[model samples]
Target: MCTVCGCGDGEVKVHGHKHHSHDHSHTHSHSHDDGLHFGDGAAGVSVPGYSQERLIKIETDILAKNDRYAELNRAKLAAQEVFAVNLVSSPGSGKTTLLCKTIEALGGQPLAVIEGDQQTQNDADRIRATGAPAIQVNTGKGCHLDGHMVGHAIEHLTLSHGSLLFIENVGNLVCPASFDLGEDCKVAILSVTEGEDKPLKYPDMFTAARLAILNKIDLAPHCDVDLDLYTANLRRVNPTIEILNLSARTGEGMSEWITWLRTNLAQKQLQGAAE
Candidate 1:
């Protein structure tokens, strides 16, 4: 039985196997985690099921556990009264640069950032230059930031109440959408240089984002990209996604971005107050 949405919670007792009663509680999701182990190990003692089904089941179980932790973390964040945004973008999408500019635009406020990267502390260094508390989590080989990792980073930073926490998730759109890091919202940034077809091609990222920033509009004229089409594609995926066309380098449209941030923060604060 799967631990989440509970479907596969059956018990397993192998033939000619002697073991204590297996606890059927918390039926973890594994493709083969439905139980019933057959055959034997090299030692002639079957250690439960070890089939391909089991592997899939184990993988599902792991992700389910991650999501459970994520929910717990989200409730904790709600209690803390923080406006946390999980920002997702691809490599060279100007995520860090845009973040630095956003920090400046926000007037050096108490914004704490969690930088995620497979390697290098470059992004953290850039954020630190802006005088905000930036904690860089090096995933080393991981492509995205999971809820558990973000939870660990938040605990490490000792993030106080009423602070803006930006999680610059590892530069990937695919896996990040599946895991929530207890954020108030998820923001996705797509540079114009990446072309207008991104939203259509990467529907998951666009759909997951509460806001989609079409960055580097300063280079829009240089690229043969149709802004309207791009927006339409995104709108098709998520009709209510707030779209922002901005250039981080030229500072054009940044004020609007800042205003959006302020509004989001204000709304989050109000929600917290009401709660």
Candidate 2:
């Protein structure tokens, strides 16, 4: 289980490996008063019978192991000049739709997707429908995709050199921020229908993301959402984060996103060549 979020780390099944299972069990306790105050300790997470020092050590060890796996994943992708992007967002943020539109807009680009969810291969099916090769990873009871899971997913994909690889992470703004999937960058998507204070409420996600996409901008007026406020909040949390406003449904402001992708891909290829 994830000591940070207390989410069960059950079996993680990558597509084509139905019999594979990983059991990650840990002992932790949660207490509720007025609300769950799990962020009061030095480790920033509370667990009964564990001292702050112990908790910190546990978290550090876990992240260190994850980082090692992430480095392996990164090296593998870099060797092929594959630019991987980790798309993260809360549920109902139109992430899958955006990914579909992105694939369509890229035209004949060589790209693949790795879809992550707690259950079902619905999103992966949608991507495959667009005629792109996609692999579905079902993280049963796991809140987010980790480096180890992504690395395994890559083995199933015959990624082309200098192609783009998109990893659509499980819909959760909290735990995904703490996990790295060896992507070149993390893109956090937020819809206008959601609260403008989402950045404030989930500051860690925004801070961790390299870019923030404010999706569903076409419905901003109808949703009574101030686009500027959302941008301001994102900048407040991550001053250096690249922000893009676009609607996948309306095909508006999509050109900018495509250009960003192309530019990043070129840079990644250049880096690989230099190495």
Candidate 3:
């Protein structure tokens, strides 16, 4: 598995639509930016014994390198007055669906997307259909988007000053919490179909997020999920996290989501003006 954050299989590869031709035939060495190798003790990288210490060091080094790149990305977004948000969730949590609806609600506001997945540009295509500039970042076997990868993506996307940029992180509640992509906020999405106890189960992800979107609420009547339990669990993990309930499929409670975005955007613009 990927030892960088213990998220996926070996060798994290980035596939950017603007720069790559989707070729998997290239030959290259697989290593984190800090020269640490991936996989589980293979390739003579991991220690034969006392493996926990070695893994800890590797994780530390990788995150340190990732943080440096994240700072650079943060600076770039700040300079442009762009409000960047990272969307993190497990698979089938309705992140892309929410993003598509959010883009539509944005109504041609200056927006761009950085879609992440282990494979496929399907999410990027969906965002593009909403008429927003989008770039797909296939992370190969990686379960998270590091700052270095997002920094490269920024070079290709045309983000306007005071605009909104969304980075849809790979579908995983675990590893994505360890890597920061310099987003202004991390929005964690959990659908009702998923258990209400998810926040309790994945405390790290919930604790890392600044806001929580309890989506697919329209189906709540059909599902056995308890909204109160979800909120309580979320608060238990992150007492200060803001939450918005909505259904992307039916557009229910979308107004509140749009208002939240606009409010954040306005604050960003105000800060930019003051600077």
Candidate number of the best lDDT: 2
The lDDT, on a scale of 0 to 1, for candidate 2 is: 0.84
Q: Which is better, 2 or 3, measured by lDDT?
A: 2
lDDT of 3 by residue, 1-275 (tens): 34534444433444444444542322222244344444433334554544756766665666777789899999999888899999999999999999999998889689889988877878988887888878777776667777877887788777788889999999998878878898998999999999998998988889999999999999999997799989999999999999988999999999999999999988988887899
How does each model score on TM-score?
Answer: 0.79, 0.90, 0.87
Write down the worst ten-residue block by lDDT for model 2: 27-36
TM-score pick, better of 1 and 3: 3
- lDDT of all the models against the reference? 0.73, 0.84, 0.80
Off by over 4 Å in 1: 1-56
1-275 per-residue lDDT for model 2 (tens digits): 45357665556777732223422222222212222223324435656776777666666667677888899999999999999999999999999999999999999999989999988888888898898888888888777888888888888888999999999999999888987889999999999999899999999999999999999999988999988899899999999999999999999999999999999999999888887
Instruction: Provide the lDDT at 168 for model 2.
Output: 97
Which candidate's TM-score is highest? 2
Candidate 1's error at 136, in angstroms? 0.7
The CA root-mean-square deviation of candidate 3, after full C-alpha superposition on the true structure, stands at 4.1
Tens-digit per-residue lDDT, 82-177, candidate 1: 789999998889999999999998995567888887666678888878877777776644567767667766665655777788999988867687
Ranking by TM-score: 2, 3, 1
